[model samples]
Target: MQAVYSLPTDVSLASHGLGGFDELPSVDVIVPSFNEDPRTLSECLASIAGQEYGGRLQVYLVDDGSENREALRLVHEAFARDPRFNILLLPQNVGKRKAQIAAIRRSAGDMVLNVDSDTILASDVIRKLVPKMQDAAVGAAMGQLTARNRNDSWLTRLIDMEYWLACNEERAAQARFGAVMCCCGPCVMYRR
Candidate 1:
C-alpha cells in the first residue's frame, strides 16, 4: 500500500530551524466504524490529524459495511484526499475484531494504535505512547480516554461515568500487570 504522498515532495517536510532530524518511532492507527454519526467521526479524525508527533503515521479506516452510504462517502472522501489515510471497505458487515485484524494486515508501520470511530485522541497521545515501544517486552501501551460528548444526553453522561471509572480501575491494574488483555477500544497504542 502506497501513500498518496510519496518521496521527494514529501521528503522536504523539514521545518526551517527544527535542529535537523531526531529518531522517532512510526505508528499506524486503525479505526473501525459502521455507520457512525458523521459529526462524531469528523471529530475523531480531526483529533488524529491534529497529533503533534513527528513520526511517520498512517490511519486505517476499516469500513464494516456501513449502511449509510452518505456516512461512508464522507470517510472515503477524506481518505481519498489525504495521503496518510487508507480506506478498507468490507463487502459485508464483519465483526469488529475481524476488521481490526484486516487493518493490521494492511498497516505499514513499526507500531499500531487502535481507536474507536467515535473517539478522539489527545494532541500528545502518539508522542507519549510511541516511545514506550522501545522496550522489548512492552507489547502495547494504552492512553487515557476522556469522553468528548458526555453532555449530549443523560444516557451519554452515564456511559461516560461508567467508562471513566472502568478505565481508572483498569489502568491501575495495568500498571501492576504491565499488560492488558485487550487494550481499551479507544486511545490505545501498540508496538509491532
Candidate 2:
C-alpha cells in the first residue's frame, strides 16, 4: 500500500515527449481473444486503430478458436479494408499465451505491446508509452488501467482503485529500481 517517494528513476521526464525518444520504434499490438463479446472486441480494435503514435503500428488480432462463428466473420469483414489490422484465425482452441506467441513469431516490430481484447486503450496510449522503452535498462512498461465498467457497483469501483494503485504506486515505485514486475496483460510495451 505504501508508494516510495524517495527513490528517483534514472531517466528524467521530457517535455513534448516526442523528443524523449531517439527513434520512434515500430510497434506491434497483439490482442488475444476467445469468446469475447463482439461489441467489446470491436471497441478494443477501434481504440488501437485510433492511436496517435507517429510510428509504424500493426495490430494482430488472434482469434483463439472462438465458438461464435458469425461474430468472428463480422469482425473480420469489418476490419478487412485496413492494412494495419491482421486477423489470425486458429484452427482449434489454443490458450491465450499460445495465441500471442504465434503472432509474436510472425511480427517484425521493434516494440511489442500486448493488449487484452476487452481493454480499450486511450488515444495517446502508444504515443506516450513507447518513450519509456528508449531506456536500455527498462525491461517492460505498463500503463495505468481502470475498469471501464467501474461505476456499475462498489466492487467495480474498488477494482478500479486497485488497478490505479497497482500502476501509480507499486509499479511507479518499482520503476525507480529498474525492477518493475509487471508487463500486465491489459496494456504493456516492451522492446521486441
Candidate 3:
C-alpha cells in the first residue's frame, strides 16, 4: 500500500507551539451515510466540529441515496453552516465502501479519517490520533468504540462487551508489534 502522509522520523512533538507539535498537516474526514437517523448524524457532525486540533480540517459527507428527506435537509443545513463541510449525493443507493472510496478520492488532506454517521468522537480525538501517525511506519489507526445504546437493550449491552473484548483486547495485542490486522469501520484514521 502507498503511504498516505510523509512524517519526519526526527520531528519533535513539543516543537509545534501547541504543546504537542507545530505545523500539523491537514486532515479530511469522510463520512458515509444511507438513510441514517438525522439526530445521530447531527451528533456525529457536532462531535467532529468540536475537535481541538490546530490544523486545517475538512469534512466530506457522502450520501448513498438516502430516501429520508428530513435527513437530507439536516445534512444540507450543516453544509451551509460549516465552510469546511462538503457533500456528495448519489442518485442511487451504493454500498458504504463505494461511498467512502469516492469521497477519499476527492479528499486533499495528508491524513484521512473515516467515521460512520452514527459515531461520535471526543473533542481531542484528532489531537490524539494525529500523533500516532508521526511514526513513519504507521499507515492507519483507529479509536475505541463504545456502544451508544448500551442501556437500551440487552443486545446492545452484549455488543458493548464484545466491542471491548474484540477491539480493546484483541486488537491492542496485534497493534503492539506493528501488525494490526484489521481496522474497525466505525472510526478509523488512514494516511492519505
Candidate 2 lDDT tens digits, 1-192: 111111122332344455356667799999888888888888888888988778899999999998985776887778766999888999887899999999999899989999888888877788777767776877787676778777777877787788778878888798788777775678887788
TM-score-better candidate, 1 vs 3: 3
lDDT ranking from best candidate downward: 2, 3, 1
Off by over 4 Å in 1: 1-22, 152-154, 177-179
- TM-scores of all predicted structures: 0.80, 0.87, 0.86
Give per-residue lDDT, candidate 3, residue 141.
75
Model 2 — TM-score against the truth? 0.87
Itemize residue pairs with steric clashes in candidate 2.
Answer: none
* Model 2 ranges off by over 4 Å: 1-22
Q: Please give the distance, in angstroms, between residue 135's alpha carbon in candidate 1 and its true position after superposition.
A: 2.3
Model 1 pairs whose backbones collide? none
Better of 1 and 2 by lDDT: 2
State the displacement of the C-alpha of residue 135, model 2, in Å, after optimal TM-score superposition.
0.5
Colliding pairs, model 3: 13-20, 16-21, 16-22
